[model samples]
Target: MLIVGLTGGIGTGKSTVSKVLRDAGFPVVDADVVAREVVEPGTHTLEKIKLTFGPDIIKNGALDRHKLGDIVFSNNTELARLNAIMQPVINSAMVDKIAFWRAQKVPVLIIDVPLLFERGYENNDYIDKVVVVTTSPQVQLERVKARDNLDETKAQNRINSQMPLADKIARADYLLDNNGDISFLEEQIKNLMTELKGIAPKYGTK
Candidate 1:
């Protein structure tokens, strides 16, 4: 299978791009969703999180993501500690899901991992292409604030935490700009999809 790793900075319409790819018949393996799944009620990840961050991180029998985010964001040591505890589990689960897609002989699999570059896992041999969604900083801030219901400062902080859009573009094999309306973004994705179809088979299509 051709694994396309799609990523974007906070609020760059990465999800929208992923939706476009899915609508175009590509199977998307969402890392964020799988991360949550691995930490659900009975999972070992949840237990480890509870033990590491304590019962306070849980609310009404479910992990309070906001509370945990607050803790990690406040302290770099805490954030690194949390990543250490969670990343391995998330990565393993993602690999397993991708393996299933490969077994099914899917032509294209989009792994929507927001931190693909930041996590330093961008060039995995399994990944055939890296597509980064791009947008201006102003647009990114505006979109993220509106979508996440976050204030300017908070949204900026989140944006600051990720790799810059410029670096992502430099590293990507393909770029989809989402600085405009939905229709424009959709068109860009369509072009990229057509481009991928031509490239994948040459790389020894699975």
Candidate 2:
């Protein structure tokens, strides 16, 4: 399996691009999905979180994502603490899924990870390339604020919490511009997937 790692800062339309790839019939392992999975109601990961961060972050026996986000979004230290707790469990689950697919003889796979660069997936043999979706800082700020129903300050804090978009772009094997309209993004994705098909013909069939 040829694993293509996808990442982008908050509000950069990485999820949308991931959908396009899946729509094109490629297998995609979404890290965000596994992050939620690892911390579900009865999991040891969630138990650890409750023990470490206190029980308040849980509501109705489930992780209160919003409550936790409110706690960590503004404080870099708290965010790091949360990442340290969650990342390993999430990565382990993701690795298992990738292994399952590879054993099934999947021709290529897409691993959508928002923190691909930060967590150092660059060193992973499975990831053949890294794609970063990006747009202007102002646009990102506005989009994040609108999408998350956050004020400018809170939204900016969330954006600042991630590795900078510029740094991600610099490290990218493929950089995509999400600074334009959806049609433009769709066109760009189509062209990019066409190129990908050439590189990995077995999985590129659409």
Candidate 3:
């Protein structure tokens, strides 16, 4: 299987690309989805998080994601602490998913991780390529504000919390520019899928 890492900043339309892949029958293991699963109520991960971030972050026997986001998004130290607690479990889950897909002999596997480079997944031996989706800063900021219902400053803070889009683009083996309409973005993804199809067959032979 060809292991491809798909990543982008907060509002660069990475989710749209992942959806496109999914609709086209590609299996995408989204880190954000796995992250939520690992921290579900009664899980050890959630217990550790409650202890670390305090019990207030939990409500109705579940982790209050908004409360936790507010605490960490404005503070880098708190964010790092949260990541330290979450990354290991999330990574393990993602690895298990990948193993399952590989065993099924899927031609291509896309891991939609927001922080692929930040967490060093790009350097993993199994990752065959990195695709970074990006758009202009203005477009990204607007999208973030509208999608998250945040003011400009808060939206910018969310964007600032991640590795910059430029840095991610610099490291990309494939780049999808999402500055235009959905049709344009879809076209780019279609081209990328075509290329990946050609490369997938020979991915592990070497």
Candidate 4:
């Protein structure tokens, strides 16, 4: 299988691109979805999280993500600690899912990892391509602010917390500019899928 690592900063439409890739018949292993899955009620990871952050992070027998997000986003140490608790579980699950796709002879597998470069995940040899979705900083700020109900400074801070969009684009084997209309974005993805399928099969077969 061809493992394509897809990444972008918040509000860059990474999820939107992932969905298009899914529609193109590629198996997508979404990290955010997997992260939420690992912390679902009755999981050991949830127990560990409760132990680490205490009871207030949970509410009504489910992980209160907003409450935890409020805490971690404001504190770098706490954010790192939360990542320590979650990354291993997420990575392991990703590995298993990728292996299953390969065994099933899937031609392409998109790993929708938001923090692919930020968290030092570039060294993974299985990633046949890196596709970075990008948008202008101003547009990103506007989108995130509206979506998250955050002020300008907070939205900028969140954007700054990730690796710069320029750097991601430079590192990417493919680029998807998402600053345009949805139809334009869809057209770009369609072109990319064609290009990727041609090279992806050659590498995976070798």
Candidate 5:
């Protein structure tokens, strides 16, 4: 099966495109969802996180993600430490999901990973292509503030935490520009689905 890696910076509506692709009948595995799943309460990963970051990060039951985020987002070394614990677990689970989709005879599988490029998922053997969603940085900041209700400084901090959109664009095999209206974005996805279907059948058929 064809594995397509979908990535974009924060507030670029990557999830919106993912939803559209899912609605179009593609099995989309969201890495962020998988990341959270791996760290669910009582999981080995969660235990490792508590051991590494401290027990205080866990709330009454679940991991206090905001607390963990506050620590990691400010320190690159801390973020790397957390990634070291979670990345492999998430990747393995994601690969299993991909295999499950392929067994069901899905033609094209979409892996919507926010850090597809950062984690080298795009270069992995499974991913056949990479699609990077993009828009103006100003639009991104505004959307993020509006969506998450963050002030300018906090929004910028979140945006700066990821690899820049321009760098991702340079690596994209396909680009979905979400600058215009929702209808325009939808149109791009429809066209992309048509194109991908043409190529995807080859893997599923034989």
Candidate 6:
């Protein structure tokens, strides 16, 4: 199967594109969803996290993501520490999902990872293509602020926490501009799907 890594900075419409791909019948393994799964109430990963960051970050029986986000997003050291604990598990889960899809004989499989480059998934030999979704910095800031209900500085901080969009675009095999409305974005995705289908066969036999 042609394994595609789909990524974008926070509030860059990566989820929207993933949804479109899902609607069009492609299998998409979302890293955020897998991240949550790996840290569920009784998991070893959650125990390690609690040990590392303390138990206050857990609410009821689950990891309080917002609480953890508040802690890590402001502190690079803390964020790196968290990534150190989580990335290996997440990567393993993603690889398992890709193998599952390949065994099912799918032509293309999309791995929706927000930190694809940050976590080094781009360098993986199995990843056939990397698609980065982008938007103007102003639009990105506004969307992040509105979606997460944060002030300008906090939203900007969240945006700054990731690798820069310009750097991601420079490394992209494909780019999806999300500056316009959903229809515009969908049209681009339609064209992208055509190209992906054409390329998938070349890698599917691997």
Clashes of each: 0, 0, 0, 0, 0, 0
Expressed as tens digits, the lDDT of each residue in 1-206 for candidate 6 is 88899999899999999999999999999999999899999999999999999989889989998889888999999999998999899989988888888899999999999999988888899888999999999999999999999999989989999999999999999999999999999999999999999988888578
Better of 3 and 4 by TM-score: 3
Task: Order the candidates by lDDT, highest first.
Answer: 3, 6, 5, 4, 2, 1
lDDT of 6 at 85: 95
If candidate 4 were superposed on the true structure by all CA atoms, what would the RMSD be? 1.3
Candidate 1 is scored at a TM of: 0.95
**Residue clash pairs of candidate 3:** none
Off by over 4 Å in 1: none
Cα lDDT for residue 130, candidate 4? 90
Q: Residue 204 CA error for candidate 3 (Å)?
A: 4.4
> How do all models score by TM-score?
0.95, 0.95, 0.98, 0.95, 0.95, 0.98
Candidate 4 ranges beyond 4 A from true positions:
none
State residue 7's C-alpha deviation in candidate 5, in Å.
0.8
RMSD of 6: 0.8
What's the lDDT for all of these models?
0.86, 0.88, 0.94, 0.89, 0.91, 0.93
lDDT of 4 by residue, 1-206 (tens): 67789999899999999998898788899999999999999999999999999999899999998788777877788889999999999999988988888888887889999999987677888887899999998999999999999888778877877889899999998899998999999999999999888877676672
Candidate 2 per-residue lDDT, tens place, 28-52, comes to 9999999989988899999989998
Instruction: Please provide, for model 5 over 5-63, each residue's C-alpha lDDT reduced to its tens digit, 9 standing for 90 to 100.
Output: 99999999999999999988988999999999998888999999999999899999799
Judge candidate 4 at residue 176 and give its lDDT.
91
Candidate 4: which pairs clash?
A: none
